[model samples]
Every structure is written in C-alpha cells, then in structure tokens.
Target: MRPGLFASPRPDNLGLHDGLLAPAPSTPNGVSSQATDSKHFVAPLPMPTDCCVSAMEKLHGIIESLGHAEIISADDGYLHAEFHTPLLGFVDDVEIVCNEQEGVCHVRSVSRMGHSDLGKNRQRVEDIRKRLEGWGYCC
Candidate 1:
C-alpha cells in the first residue's frame, strides 16, 4: 500500500466498477477478498525491447555531438539509456527504450528540457538510427 493512502494493506471490502462501488466478499479468515482482484489492478504497459550495442553506439554519438553524455542501463530483458545533456549549465535527462535482440529503440524525452528541445532534434535522432541500420543493426 502507498503511504498516506491507507491505514494498512488490508483489502477494502468494496469493489469499484464503472465508477460505482459495491461490497466485496469476506474471506474465511475475516479478511476482505478485494485483494483477489488486485492482480487486475496492474495492467502491463507497452515497452520497447529491440536494441543492440551497435545501436547504442550510434545513439551515443548523436547525443554526444549535442554535448551530452549517454548512460546505458541494462538488465536481463531490458536495455534503457539515459541521456544527460547540458542545458543552461545543468543536466537534462532523456530516456531510451530498446529491444536488445531486435536492435530497435524508442527514444523519448522524460525531462522538461529535453522534451522542449525534441522537436528541433528529430533529424539528429533519425540520423543516428539510420547510421545504426546502415551498419546492419535492424529490427
């Protein structure tokens, strides 16, 4: 349970549907079974997973040319990058998602500074992706 939202993690005996609330079943132990449907509460979100070191190198150069540093963060199934660009003497953060196997990446600006600058930087991003493809990294 999130802080300041509930007294405890106990399931609420009320079910919500179409904005209407209804009572939920109580378990044999007197615990509310509302948590039984908690599994449905978390819906999977779309994620990009196609990325490769070659593509990462391509993106690194693109951001580097913009006076930024590319930081790669990877796990077993995900490869994410955070681009730290110097803006107004401070670092601006940008996020990148990629599928390591497909060598494809979806880049986005997660910070305000990067978002505002994205419109004018589209060509640069495209250039990097194209370069990566020319080198045989493809999705």
Candidate 2:
C-alpha cells in the first residue's frame, strides 16, 4: 500500500486537559492509561526515580530511538509523538503526561483513522514500557 494512503486528519483533541490526557475513543483503535473501561485502559508508567523533567527527557529519547516516530510537542512534563507504520504510514498519536505528585506518566495512543488497530496502540505502549525498563525504570 502507498504510504499514508489511509492517513486521516489529526484529531483536534490531542493534548492534556485539566492535568489529564484526553480519554481514549470508544472504538477499539486506542488505549489510554486514564480510561475507565477495561478495553481502553492501561496502567500508567511509573515516573522515574529522578525528576519529572528528567523522566520526560528520557521518554523523549526513547521515542526518538524508535524509527518512524515523530515528536510533535514536548514540554517539561508532557510529550506528544506520532508513530507511522512502515508499510501504510498509518499515524498513531501517543501522548504522555508526567504527574509528579502521582509519580506516574499518563499515556494515550490512538490511531488517526480506523475502527480497530489490532492491538497496535497497546503494543506500542508496551514497547515503550520495556524501553523505559531498560533505562532502570520500573512500573
């Protein structure tokens, strides 16, 4: 398939709101640490023992190391990235927000267009979790 043949326009609600990332869509194409439903819920990443800024920096580095990933915006305690599938260039938006008081990083990953992602979003988040583990960070 041609790259980005199925790419959809980016969603307007793509950032944190009132200190929480936007909820995952009702469809199965997304997953969120903040979601109340089991189908869309994933445990948040535990913040690194260091500071929020340091954790965000490490998270940013890990995302950059993943080929085909693009950093959209990054702040002191928040990050947003887009990961493109190699074959179709399907875009998946991943957002992370560091809650220092809670000591966890809220995450959400969703396909830009699709009814089902076949677990892609969940897998991507798991992959990130593993990479963070390699950095001596644990859940």
Candidate 3:
C-alpha cells in the first residue's frame, strides 16, 4: 500500500475502471467517463512502535500547551484531541490523522462547543504543527 495508490476492490466487475477517468478497459465510445469515487483506498502502515511513540509525544506536548488538551483517543495509528481554545473561547475537538507509511500526521481542528466560542482554533493547529516539526516528525 503506497501513500495514495489503492487496488481495485472488485476487479471482476470493472469496478476499478468505473472509478478511473481513463478506464483500464476502454469502452467502444473511446471516451472514458471521469470517475469521482473509489470503493477502497489503502493507506501506508505506521512506522515502528518506537518511532510512532516518539512522534506522539511531540504531538501530545503541543496539544497540552494549547489548553491542557486531553487526548480523547489515541492509538499507534491515529490520535483524537480535545481542548479549550482561548482564542476561540471554546473547547474544540481536533483530529490528528497520521500515516505510518511515512510517519506523517495531519491535524484538523474540528468545531466543538464547551463553554466558549470559536476563535482561533486554526492557530492552535499551526502551533501543533510547528511543535511536531521541532520534535522531528517531518512537520
């Protein structure tokens, strides 16, 4: 499994061609329809446990500093974070998606209500990214 390449979920049904703009098995019309959806996608596996843990620690620190953010859920594969954002004047639930194939993480701050309003939740994401870079997680 590469970063974004996926195998056909059902090769027998031409399902793979249905999702491809240039159909693998071209039609008589000689013009393939643009496919916009895929039935399946394979993601790269995570790095070694030690490497993953090290990166996670770096991410943890960034979230903690943001607002004592508590890790709602975390595993070697992914991490879900929740914390108060002074900038937004509210608590936000952020999802940090990681790809072990390359040991890379993508953090997206999702809106969550918790005794405050949404302000600069995006900024918190930036801070987290910078810290990850500092911690050597490929940013």
Candidate 4:
C-alpha cells in the first residue's frame, strides 16, 4: 500500500492563513496552540529569549531528533513537518509559527486521517512542550 494510503484528503486550510498556522480541524484528531476552544487549544511554546530565528532552529533540531519527523519546509519564522506512526503508518502534519515580539512558538498538529486519534495529537503536543521546556523554553 502507498504511504498514507488511508490518510484523509489534504485539508484546504492546511498552511498559514492570515499570518497564522491553520486552526486545528474540528475533529478530535487535531490540536492547535492558537485555537479558541478547550478541545483544540494547546499552549504555545515560550521562547527563552527574544531571538525567534534561533529558537526555531532549535525546534527544528528537536523535531528531527524525535525520529519520524520529516521537515517538509522551514524558514526563520515558520516550519512544517510530517510525523508518522510506527505500526499503522499514520501521518500527522505539524506546523509551527514563531512570533518574535511575543517570544512564543505557535503550533498545530493534526492527523491526516481519522476522527479520533486516541489522544495522540494532544500527547504529541504535550511531549513537544516538555521537550522544549527541558531546553529552557516554556510552554
């Protein structure tokens, strides 16, 4: 079978919209730091300093070290990555946007398929938050 064969269609709202990473899908398979609802809201990672560029670079390294993450695109303030599950080969798209003035990294993570992810999306964000915090960044 092809990779992501069971994956849902690429979301219309996938990338940054109006200078913000797209909101999490209404389904429980997604979560976003910028979301307004408790179900979709995850806290943005707080930067250790005023340098968002350097912070993003650090985040890049962290994601790479997480194993299944493949960074599809990245710039000083924005990044996109794909994370694959080990057994079933599910794919999740993760995006991060750095706000320099606010010194935070806004993030969104969504499964490409499924209405429920068994809390995987939320766990991943929490994991990322913990890892970033260990690096002296806050979330």
Candidate 5:
C-alpha cells in the first residue's frame, strides 16, 4: 500500500468567506463555479424557490448519494465533503456555498495533492451538477 494512503492534510483554503466559497487554484487539479477565469470557471448550481433549509437538504442528499462522498461539515448554507479515489485513496475536498438570496449554490472541488488531476475535479463538479439537475434542480 502507498504510504499515507489513509491520511489527507486538511485543506487550508476552504469554507465560506463573505458568503462565497473559495476560488479554485490556477492548477488543473481544482475547479470552482465562482471562479472568474474560464480555466477554472464552472456554472453555479441553481436552487429552487423553496426555503433555504429545503435547498440545503437537497444539496446534502446529492452529495451523500455519491458513493465515495463523506460529508465533513455542514450547516444551513454551507457544506464540505471529502471524496476518495477508489484505488489509491486520494482525497478531494468539495465545498458548497449556498446563496439563498440569489438562489444559487457556489461550488469548489480540489485535490489534496498532485500538480494535476487530469480534470477529475472539474468532472466531479459536472457530475454533481448533472445529478442535481436530474433531481429537479437547475444550474
């Protein structure tokens, strides 16, 4: 087994800062809907007109439904989850920042290590986006 297979350092650049999730790093190993640049830009999730709690529950449900996902922290409008790569156990941190007033949810996903992740972070967010849409949410 690879050393540190079960260990992942806590991400230093996570959480809601001023009602927004942190931007994705310049590296390809990260992606964020809030990112201004095209390289890291993803469309934010669109929330239904329901209450914030209901929207959060839907978001939480989608994340939890992902087989490899483990929610680390959550609250009324924020959530952090870790997704593990099946083979090597690489960890990716995903955070969602819900802006109830705007009816959108910002997202960020980043690998804990490596200079590049072959677009996995971007793909992961896209996958979640699709799943949310399938469940009657929009983006």
Candidate 6:
C-alpha cells in the first residue's frame, strides 16, 4: 500500500483540556489513559523520580527509537507523534501529557481512519510502556 493512502486528516480534538487529555472516541480504534470506558482505557505511565521534563525527554527518546514515528509537536510536558504502520502505512496519532502532581503521564492513541485497529493502539501504548520500563520507569 502507498504511504498515507488511508491516512485521515489530523483531528481537531487533540491535546490536553482542563489538565486532561481528550477522551478516547467511542470506537475500537482508539485508546486513552483518560478514557472512562474499560474498552478504551489504559493506565497512565508512572512518573520516574526525575522531573516531568526529564520523563518527557525519556519518552521522546523512546518514540524516536521507534521507526516510522514522527514527532509532530513537543512542549515541556506534552508530546504528539504520528506512527505509520509498516505494511499499509496507516497513520495513528499519539498524544502524551505529563501530570506532575499525579506522578503519571496520560496517553492517547487513535487511528486516523478505521472502524477497528485490531488492538493496535493499545498494543502500541503497551510497547511504549515496556520500553519505558526498560529505562527503569514503571507504569
């Protein structure tokens, strides 16, 4: 498949609102730490002993190590990245917000265009979590 052949335009409802990332959509193609429904909910990543900025930096490194990931925007405690599948090149948006007070990093991952992702979003997040754990950070 051609790259981005199935990619949809970036959604307007991304980023943190009122100190929380946007909720996951009511579809199986998305997953979010802030989601209320079990089907779309994933636990936030536990912050390390270092500062939130450090955690974000570490997270940035992890994302960078993953091929086909493009950093869209990164702020002090927030990051947005797009991941392309190896075969079809389908795009998936990933957003992360560091909550210093809560000692966690909230994350959201959603397919750009699809009714179901066959659990790709969740698996991606889990893969990230595992990588973070390798750096001595726990979820």
In candidate 3, stretches whose alpha carbon ends up further than 4 angstroms from where it belongs are 1-50, 85-89, 113-119
Give the per-residue Cα lDDT of candidate 5 at 82: 88
Q: What digit string (tens of lDDT, one per residue) describes model 2 on residues 37-71?
A: 99999999878545788778889999999878989
Measured by C-alpha RMSD in angstroms, how accurate is candidate 5? 2.9
Residue-pair clashes per candidate, as listed? Answer: 7, 0, 4, 0, 0, 0
lDDT tens digits by residue: candidate 5, 57-132: 7888988898778888889778899888777788889998777677788889988888898999888888888987
Error (Å) of candidate 4 at residue 93 is 0.6
Q: Positional deviation of 25 in candidate 4, in angstroms?
A: 1.0
Q: Model 3, 1-139: lDDT tens per residue?
A: 1111221121222212232212312211111112122311112222343466666766777777765476766775456665543343344455554445554454444333222223344456556656656666532
lDDT of 1 by residue, 30-51 (tens): 1111124542111111223544
Least lDDT summed over 10 consecutive residues: which range in candidate 3?
A: 24-33
Per residue, candidate 6 scores C-alpha lDDT tens digits across 40-89 of: 99999879545788788889999999878999999978999999987677
Superior candidate under lDDT, 1 versus 2: 2
Estimate, for each residue in 34-69, the C-alpha lDDT of model 4 and write its tens digit: 999999998988885577877787789888988877
Off by over 4 Å in 4: 1-12
TM-score to true structure, per model? 0.38, 0.92, 0.50, 0.88, 0.88, 0.91
Query: Whole-model lDDT for model 4 versus the true structure?
Result: 0.82
User: Model 1 off-target regions past 4 Å?
Assistant: 1-67, 77-87, 100-103
TM accuracy, model 3: 0.50
**Candidate 1 Cα RMSD after full superposition onto the native fold (Å):** 16.2
lDDT of 5: 0.81
Model 6 stretches with alpha carbons more than 4 Å out: 1-3
Error of 3 at 63 (Å): 1.1
